[model samples]
Target chain A: MAQLTMVQALNKAIADEMERDSSVFCLGEDISDKDGGFGGAFAVTRGLYEKFGEERVLNTPISEILISGAAIGAAMVGSRPIADLQYGDFIFCMMDQLCNQAAKMCYMSGGQVKVPMVLRAPVGATQRGAQHAQSLEGFFTRVPGLKVICPATPYDAVGLLKTAIRDDNPVIVFEHKKLYGGKRVEAGAIAPVGEVPDKEYTIDFGKAEIKREGTDITIVANLLMMYRAMEAASHLEKEGISCEVIDPRTLVPFDFDTVIKSVKKTGRLMIVHEDTYSNGWGAEISAYVAEHAIYYLDAPIVRVTTYDTPIPFSPVLEDYVIPSTERIIESVRQLMDS
Target chain B: MEAKMLLEMYEQMDLIRTYEETLYYLFLEGIMPGSIHQSHGQEACAVGMLYGLRKTDYMASTHRPAGHDIAKGVSVKDMMCEMFGKEDGCCKGRGGAMHTGDITVGAIPANAIVGGNIPISTGIGLSLKMQKRDDVVVCFFGDGASNEGAFHEGLNGAAIWKLPVIFVCENNLYGASTSIKNTLNIEDIALRADSYGMPGEVVDGNDVLAVYAAAQRAITRARKGEGPTLLELKTYRIAGHSRSDGCAYRDDVEEAEWFARDPIELLKNKILKEKIADEQILADIHEKNEQIVNEAVDYAIEAKEPSVDDVLLNVYWEGD
Candidate 1:
């Protein structure tokens, strides 16, 4: 086992996949290392351009629409493509291609073609204001043909990216900006160091990882919120309240059984995410738990999510809007008391 | 182009026109299921552009897909079945009239969104280049699609990557009854290609030989790895954009002007004057094309609708 950052792990996964399959090439803006171009906006594609050459590690113009559409076309015609957008917010620019063409090509073609493409979009709020920062997994999760994954750890990032690259369908993998321990570090960025196995392994979709064990309540979270949930759990342990944490690796093929099992044991559940509170991913989790595991819940299911407002530039307002550990702790303590 | 190739283009154009006319007649009789964006007068554009293409070369079509689908060799029976929402459709009843296509013949599902298929064509070109394949992709769209943001994005990408794609914009004068004059600022949509660093050409879309010659030049340039070319064919759809359109936005004077230069008629006169084919031969070709359309209609009408269980399938592919 070797310790690696999330970005490093992702780079390794893409490099390995490209090496294993030549058809697996990357296309995005500023993804190349030549001509002083950044190896992607966050350095996730660093060294890949040098290693795989320009053809595989491609750098396109500022065109998310073309990038997504081209990737779908390539996938439809027997080539695998992994397209990346500089930010998750730009996903809207290519929504038609991502949602309509890439997502529906196989279904519309009657399974005659498979769009084996992965769209790597870095999500989550940082200092960047309304346009750049957004937890966009919720938007894409609603799209049926896409496999949406939110990886919170380096191990999960590496394995899941590998799986997404090889998967014979369109996969949207949302990597949190804070978890990317690259050279361009953001303020309040938590360094995620985890051991990645030396051999090739892939984690199946719809599987949830229990980050921590508990008996009183279950805290379901993903991406940056998963770290907050873990922090809240640790602080609650000092107060003699145990909170089990569940990280759903993927959203569409959600691991309801894992959350349901944990809820069945703990008899309480709390869902948290950085997406807006209204119609957020947390709401879906809450609805699912209510529908299937209502009897197991000792109290009503609660959701701790970002406020229904665009992310602001000021740190205070941003922190206040996004769900903090204090908010998660308060929500969990109140649920337990009830 | 050879005489045989020119004749093949004529037959393709005739087939597309007959298919569209049949669809229009069916719509008028209230027998068709969905609205159609018929490409009647613009037959030569699709036929000339696609006639020389290999079956494996890709084509990305728009809402007006009949002409491109016909020229691309899409199974007319399956296309008709798709329009009828039958079980054995090329799209298996999922994609209807506007989204008709068959991947077996290298037609990606026709994108309904305006300018949506441009980027997809660029991606196919990228794939072909990566796979070291000699195939080039031809993306068909209306004049208005040239104004979409995707049009700029896709063309810029194609130019930068030097992908093997020929963007064939059938500038049919109108976008859903809104004239191109109101939507575009440039004289020709081909001029907009200059901004993307690609050669742009405007061909007389009603002339099969002219359209075919232009397409052959662009396709040859693309296959030679020279890069993408924008071929804006100056054509017009003889019918309305969709089923409900009454041609109110268009005047009869304009209609008469275009009808006088109809592509099928242009080819028929040329064939007769040059003695390339006798009037009887041309008449027989028209009769054969009508029969093909009729047979497809019958086959599609006889096909069954998909079962409910199939609705849940193909959302995601299942594999190890």
Candidate 2:
């Protein structure tokens, strides 16, 4: 096993899957070129076209709608397509094709057709602005037929992407822009590290990983927010707060069982996310936990999220809007005190 | 040239008409579950086009897809069962009238979204071409769809790739009551094909023979690596956009005009006028068709409904 960044893990998964299945082909903007824009905006698909030919690792035009529609159609007719959107925010242009057509086709056809496609979208606030920085998991999770996965570690990124490619249904894998250990325009950025398996393997979805062990409180988070929650847990450990951190890798078939069991032990729950507070993914988790694990809870669940406003381009406003480590710490301390 | 091929065309037309009429009555009786976009007047376009296609060749149809589905060989029983929301229906009762379709029959489920099937058909064509298959895709859309950006994008893409696709526009004048004349700048929807550098042809859609002849030419061209064609069938819909409306938007004069030249009646007269079949043979064909339809209804009525547990099934394949 070797320690790899999330970007390296994604490249490995795609490279392995390409070698494993001849049907798998990747098409997106700037996914093919070597130094210019290999892999993607995060370099996840770098060195694929070099190993495979241009035919397999295709560089498409800047048409998101056509790219998504073509991927859906290609998948329907029998070609496993892994389409990449530069940012998750751009996925709005192709939502009809992804949501209505790809998601509903097999079900609408009564199990007659299968859309075996993987859509890779990079999400998270990196101080880019309102257009680029958005945690798009909330939008996609609402769609019924789509499988939404947001992997937090290198191991999970490799395994989950492999699983998504092999899946018959269309799967949307959202990678956090800040979490990818790569160069950013700004001075400070998130660069979480994890080890990845050298051998080929895939992890099952709907499973939660307990990042840190504790008994006093449970901190639920995903993607970039997961790292923030982990940092918050570390700080609380010094004060004897002993908070548990749970990361749900996949949102669609969420691993609620693991979280519920952890909540039972801890007797307190708190959710942290970068998405807007109103109708964010944290609300769903909070509601579910409140309904099922109410008797086990010691205090009301607290949610620390970005303010209900569009992501601003200014660094100061953006920092204030998004949930920071300080905010997570405050929320956890409040829950524990209560 | 052959007599059986001509008879097959007529049979398919009759089947479409009878099936639509049956669905109409079922809806009127309050037995059917969903709304329908019937293809009462455009049977010739479906029967004529599909009659010439192989089972391997694919067809992507529009909202008014009952005719195309039946003509392309979707079983009547499954279609009726689907309308009844039974599990045994073609789409396990998930898709209703507007989306009625069967992939095994070489028909992707009929898309209810206007012009949505254009790019999808192009994709099917791409797959066929990539695999080096002789199969061609016939994408059936409405006149309203010709004005859609999807139509332009899909057609341009298909033409540039020289993919084997037949962009069939069943231009029955209106798209949900808004006349094509109001939406389109050009008089003939087929003319848009010239912009894509593909051959565009207009045919009397009500005339099955004319439509069949045009389809044959396009299919032959596509089978070779000659690229795509846009065939605009000048036809009309006798029914409203769906089951609820009375189609009052259509002029009575134009309605009477199209009815007089009914594709079913036109084909019947051609058969009788040319002495292709006698009264006895016609009677026998009608009786056999009635029996087939009756048996289909019986099978559909007796079909099972999917359990609540199965709702979660088929969302993703769990590997056999």
Candidate 3:
């Protein structure tokens, strides 16, 4: 076993897949030095070009539509393409290609065609402002034909990415920039390094990871919010508040069973995310629990999320907008007191 | 070209026209469940470009795709059933008229979004080139798509990769009511290829032979690894953009002029002059096509509507 950042773990997963399957190739802006920039905005594909060469690790033009559309087309034929979108916001430019074309092809072709494609987008607020700091999993999760995977840990990042590559349908892997834990010599950085396994393994989708187990209340979160939930739980424990922290690693085929069981035992639930309050990923989980696990709940399911507004570039404003440890603790205390 | 090739092109154009006319009637009667973008006057472009294509070769179509789908050899019965939203349709009743397609028939569904299929077509061509296959892809789009960024990006990518693809812009004067003259700066859409360093050709779209000749040259260039060619078929749409309106925005004088240059009438005259088919034989072909169209409608109406469970079946492929 070896420690790896989420970015390193994603690189490992892509490298492993490309090495194992010749059909697996990556294309995106700044992927190859010969073609220009240095392997993506966050450098997740850093040094892949040296190992796989320029062909497999292709650097495409700054055309998001072409990048995603090409990936879909290649996947349609025989190749499995892993398209790296530098930021999640740019996905809006290629929405028709991804949402309409790639997602619907398999279903439209009556299962005769399968778009085995993976879209890697770095998301989360890191002082990048409204355009760059969006947690795009909420938008992608709403789409039916595409699989949405959000990994909070480096171990899960590597495992889930490998699984997504093998999935016959299109999968969008939303990586929180903060969780990648890569060293940023820039002005501001919120990265946290984590441990990952060197052995080949895969984290199955629709499975939640119990980060911290307690008897009183369950705090469900994902991505960056998962880390905040843990911090809140630790703080709550000091005050005799037993809190269980659970991270639903994937959002689409969500781990509803785990959340339901955790709620059944704890009899209280608080969902947290970075997306806006209205129609966020939390709404789906909350609606599901309300429908299926309402009788088990001893308190109303409280949702802690960002205010419905564009993420501000100012660090203080962004910090105030995102789900914070204090907010998680406050939501937990409210649910517990109820 | 051989006389048989000409006859085959004529037959393909006839099939496309008949299919559109059939769909038009079905849609008018409100028998068809969804709206349709009829390729009523765009038969020459589809048949001319696709008639020279191999079955393994690929093509991407615009919203008006019945013509291309038929020319690509997608069964008329399946398309009709799909329009009726029946279980036996090509897309299993999931895709309506705008999205109807059969990958098995080398026709990627007709994308309703402008320029949506352009980059996808380039990807298909890239796949063929990567696999060392000589298969060429013909991407059919409207003149409106020429202004789309995807068209520029896809063409540039195809040129750089030297992928075997033919970008066919069927400039039928209008894009869903907005005329090309208003949307585009340049008169000839094909001339835009100069920016991408590709050979651009403008052909008489109503003249089936001329369209076929241009397509043959472009397809040949692509097969020889000369990269893509932009073929702008200066054509006209005899019908409305969709089921909604009847070309009220279109100039009546211009409409009458294009009607005189109808691809079907032009092809019929050529067939008669070339002695390809006598009037009796042509009448017999018409009778047979009418019977076939009638049978397709009957099959579509009688076909079973998909069950509720069918919606969840093809969402993903489980190694099948």
Candidate 4:
């Protein structure tokens, strides 16, 4: 085992997958090493171009539609491609390619083709204003054929991404910019470095990882919010309120079993996410828990989410808009009081 | 081209015509389930461009894809079953008229979105290049697709990488109801290729041999590791854009002029004039192709409906 950051782990995962499978390649803007280029927007792919050469690590023009469509097409014809987008907000530009082409190719072709591809996008409110900063997991989770995964730590990043690369379906990996603990540091970034195994290991989808074990209440979160939830759990422990924290590694093939089990044990549930409240992924989890484990609940389910507004540039307003550890504690206290 | 190749092209064109004409009547009688964007007058474009392509070479098609699908070697029975929405359909009844294809024959499922297949075809070309294979991809779209952002981005990517993709534009003068005259400011759609630094050509879409010749040059260039080519086939659709669309938006004089240049008739005349085959041989080929379509229709009508239990299947590929 070796201690590594999330971005370094992701780079190693791609390099290892490409090394194992010749058909695997990387394509996106500024991913190549020609002319001393940086390895993508977050530097997760920094050394791949030099290691794999230009054919395997291609640098595309600023064309999201072409990048996505090409990935789908190449995947359909026996190539496993890992496509990258600088920001998750740019997915809107290639919605037709992702939603119509990649997502539906297998079903539309009557099980005749498989689009084994992965799309990586950095999503978080990093004070880049509305166009650049948005947590887009909610949008893609609603899409039927696409699988959505958000990895918070270095270990999950490598395992989930490697599994996504090998899976015979189109997967969207939403990596939070604040959680990408590499050289490029952000204003409010939390660098979560963890030990990743040197040997090959893959994490199956639909399995939730419990960050902390407790009994009073269960907190479900992912990406940046996962770390925040852990912090909330630790803070709540001081006040005699034990909290259980759960990070759902994959959103689409969600491990509802783990959440249900945690909720059963705690008899209370509170969801936390950086995405906006209205129709966010938290809503789905709330509804599912209500439908399946309502009788186990001692209090009504609560959600701590970003306000229903675009991410602002001001640090104070941004922090206020997104969920905070204080908000989780307060929500837990309210649920405990009720 | 050899006489055998010329005859094969005519046979495929005849088959597409018969298949489409048969579907037209069936749809009119309310027998078929879904709507069709028929390719009635654009037979030569599909047959000519796809005649000699190997089964490993990919072809991406747009909404009006029957001719292109059939010409690219999707079986008559599979397409007919697809039209009937049966379990034996090309897409197992999930994808209807606009989305019929067989990937085993190198036809990616036809995209119904206007210019959706352009960038996808470029990706297939990239895969072929990366695999060190000499196979090429032919992408088919209408003049309406030329206005899409996908067209510009797809063409530019293919040019920069020198991917072996042939972007074929069948300028049928309409994007559904609106005429291309109102949509495009330029006279030639092929001229847009200049922006991407690729060779572009215009051909008589009604002439099968002309389209074949242009396709040969483009395909050969692509096979030699030269960049993509944009071939604009100036044609017109004799049928409406879809079911129940009357030609009120089209001028009678323009329609008459294109109708007279019927691709099948042009091929028939050429075959007889050059003595490639006698009139009796041409008649036999048409008869045989029509009979094949008739048998396919009968087979589709008797094919089984897809099981509801399998409706949730194929949504995701579980394993090998």
Candidate 5:
């Protein structure tokens, strides 16, 4: 086992997959060393260009449509491509390619072709204004054919990404900027360093991991929110309020069963996410729990999400807008009181 | 081209023409479901560009894709079944007229979104280059597609990487109801290739041999790893943009002029005048294709509707 950050784990995962499968290749803007070695927006692909050579690690122009469409096309013809976007917000530029083409190719083609590709995007509120900081899981989770994955820790990052690379369908890996612990540090970044196993291992989608075991309440979160939720659980433990924290590794093939089971034990549920309030992924979980495990609930389900507005540049306003551990604790206290 | 090759090209063009004419009537009779964007006048463009391509070479098509799909070697029966929304269709009834294709024959399912297939073709080309394969990809779109951002991005990527992709623009002078003259400021869509540093050519879309010769040059260049070519085939669609269009937007004089230069008739006259084949041989080819199309129609009419239990299938590939 070796201690690694999320970015290092992701780089290792890509390198390992490329080493194993010749069909696998990387393509994005500034991904190669030829483009001053930025190694993608977060330096996750830093040494890949040198290790794999220019043919495998391609540097594309600032054309999101071409990157996405070409990835879909390459995937259609037996190439497993890992396409990267600088920020998750840029995915809007290639909506037709992702939502229309890659998502629907298999069904539209009547199972004639499969787009075995991965799109990696960094998402989080890092004080970069509205266009840069957006939690895109909500938007992509609503898309049917595409699988959405958000890995919070280094271990899950390697395992989930490896599995996504092997899957026969298109998957979007939404890595939070704050969680990608590397040189480019942000204000609220957690910089979690975890030990990744030396042996090859893959994490299946639709499987939830319980970060902390408790009984008073179930806290469901992912990516940056997962770390924040863990912090809240530790804080709540001092006040005699035991909290169970769950990280849903994959959003589309959501591990609802695990969440429901957790809710059953705690008899209370509080969902947290950085995405906006209205129609967030938390809303879906709330509804699902209300439908299946309502009788087990001691209190009404609560959602702690960012306010319904674009992410602002100001640090104070950004913290106020997005969910905080204090908000989670207060929400948990209210649910406990009720 | 040999006499056999010329006759085969004529036969394929006629098959597309006859299939489209048959579908038009079936649609008129209310027997066919959904709408269609027929390629009635641009038969030579599809046949000429795709005639000699190996089954392994990829072809990406746009909304008006029946001619491209058929010419790319998707069986008439499969296409006919797709038009009828039957289970035996190439796309298993999921794709209607605009989205029919057979991937086994290197025809990716036709994209219904205008200019959607342009960038996708580049990806296929990239895959071929990565695999060290000499196979090429031919992407077909209308004149209006040249103005789309996908066209610019796709063509530029192909040029920079020298990917073997042939971007074919069938400039039928209109996009749905709008004329290219009103939409584009330039006279020749091929000139747009200069922006990407690729060779661009214009062909007489109504002349089968002329289109064939241009395609030969472009395909040869691609096979030699010389990069992408943008070929603008000046042609006109004999039918309306879709099922409901009465074509009131078209000018009668221009329509009559293009209609007289029918690609099939041009090929027929060329075949007879050049002594490539007698009139009787050309007539027999048409009759044989008509019979084949008729058999396909009968097969499609008898094909079963897709099972509801399987409706949820293929949404995600479960296994082999």
Candidate 6:
């Protein structure tokens, strides 16, 4: 095992998948180049163009609809395509393709066709303003046919990406901009440099990883917020408030068992996400835990998420809006005090 | 057009017209489940563009997909079953009228949203190229769909990659009730194809031979790795856009002018003028196709509905 950044792990996963499957290919804007293409907006696909060549590492125009819809069509045929969107906010441009075409093709075709394509987009408020910043997991998780995965660490990124590429359905991998540590670094990035194995490995969906073991409270988070939750747990430990941090890697195929077990142990649940609070992924978790594990919980479910407003361009407001370590700690303290 | 091809297209056109007429009557009787996007007065464009295509080749259609699906060789009985929401339907009763298709015959499920299938065609072409196959994909849309974001993006992508895809815009002179004259500045939708650096041709959609010849050139260019070509079939929608539309927006004079140039009527006249087939042979073919549709209707009415146990099946692909 070696320490690799999330971007490096993702690049390795794509290269490995391309090498393993001849039908596997990638298409996006500025993703292809023999001499180190833009490697995508976050440099995740760096050097894939030279290794896989133009046929596999195709460079498309700045058309999100075409990128996504073309990937759906290619996946409908024989090829397994990995389509990349420069930013997650651009996903709205291909909403028809993703929510309608890709999501309904298999069902609409009576299970005759399989759209085995992967759409990778860098999500989260990275100070790029409203047009570029948005956590799209909530939008996609509500979609029945599409699988949504958000890997925070390098190990999960490589493993889940491989699984997503190999899965026989449309999978959307929402990579957090702050977690992607490479040549380009974000202003307030917390690079989760975990050890990724050298040998091929795949992490299955619906399995939540417990980041920190504790017995006071359970914090369920994913993507960048997962790191924030861990930091909150570290801070809360000093004040005699132990918190168990759980990263439910995939929002669609959620590992509720792990979350339930953690909630049962702690007797408290606090769900956090970078998405807006209104109808956020955290709300779903809160509801599920309330319905199933309510008897075990000693306190009401607390949710820490972004406000129901657009991500601000100003760093101060953005930081204030997004759930920070202090906010998570304060929420934990309130739950403890209550 | 050759006699064999001409007669085949005529028979298919007749079948589509009869099928559409039958559906119109059925919908009027309140027997149909969903709203209909009938493709009347545009049979020549669908038949002429799809009749020459191989069953292995792919085609994506708009909401009005019965003509294209039938032309692309989707089973009549399955399409009927789908319309009836029967278990034996092409999509196992999952897809209703608007989303009709049989992937086994290379007709992707029809896109109800306008211009939704254009970029999908580009991807299908990309897949064909990646798989090292010569098969081409044809994307059928309306003049209004040409203005959608998917159209520009899909066409531009196909052009740059030289993907084997034909973007067929059935300029039926209307985007629903809105007139093309008011919506678009250009008279011909083919002119927009120039923006993508591909050759665009405008064809007389009322004349099957003209549409057939134009489609042949586009298909040939695509097969030769020359890139995509846009074919604008200048046609008109004789029927309302949907079931609720009364077509009050269309003037009687305009309707008569287009009705006089009906594609089926035009094709029949051409066949008779060229002495391709006698009146008896044409009548016999029409009678046969009508009988087929009649049989499909009967089968669909008698087909079984999906069981309660299977209400959960075929949502996500459980591969073999």
Global lDDT scores for all candidate models? 0.89, 0.85, 0.86, 0.93, 0.93, 0.90
Of candidate 4 chain A, the 10-residue stretch with the lowest lDDT total is: A31-40
TM-score of chain A of each: 0.98, 0.97, 0.97, 0.99, 0.99, 0.98
In order of DockQ, best first, we have: 5, 4, 6, 1, 3, 2
Off by over 4 Å in 5: none
Q: Any runs in candidate 6 off by more than 4 Å, and if so which?
A: none
**Whose DockQ is higher: candidate 1's or candidate 6's?**
6
Clashing pairs in 4: none
Computed on C-alpha atoms, the DockQ of candidate 1 is 0.77
User: How many clashes (backbone N, Cα, C below 3 Å) per candidate?
Assistant: 1, 2, 0, 0, 0, 0
Point out where model 3 deviates above 4 Å.
A183-194
Most DockQ-accurate candidate: 5
Higher-scoring candidate on TM-score, 4 or 6: 4
Task: Calculate candidate 1's fnat.
Answer: 0.83
Chain A of model 6 scored by TM-score:
0.98
lDDT string for model 3 (A262-306, tens) is: 999999998899888899998989999999989998888888999
Q: Write the per-residue lDDT of candidate 6 for residues A40-77, one digit (tens) a residue.
A: 88888889877888889888888999999889999999
The complex in candidate 5 yields a DockQ of: 0.86
B319 Cα displacement, candidate 6 (Å): 1.3
In candidate 2, what are the lDDT values of residues B167-256, reduced to their tens digit? Answer: 999989988888877888888988889898999999999999899899999999999989999999999888888888787788889899
What digit string (tens of lDDT, one per residue) describes model 5 on residues B1-320? Answer: 48888899999999999999999999999999999989999999999999989999999998889999989999999999999999999999998998999999989899988889999999999999999999999999999888899999999999999999999999999898999879999889999999999999989998988998999899999999999999999999999999788899998998999999999999888889999999898889889999999999999999999999999888887666
Report the lDDT tens digits of candidate 4 across residue range B1-320.
58888899999999999999999999999999989988999999999999989999999998888999999999999999999989999999999898899999988889999999999999999999999999999999999999999999999999999999999999999999999889999999999999999999999998999999999999999999998999999999999999889979998999999999999999989889999999899889989988999999999999999999999888898577
Docking quality class, candidate 4: high
Candidate 5 clashing pairs?
Answer: none
Worst 10 residues of 3 chain A by lDDT: A181-190
Candidate 1 residue pairs that clash:
A70-B123
Instruction: Give the runs in model 4 whose Cα sits over 4 Å from its true position.
Output: none
Estimate, for each residue in A23-89, the C-alpha lDDT of model 2 and write its tens digit: 7888888888655665677777788988998767877666676677768877888888899999999
User: What docking tier does model 3 reach?
Assistant: medium
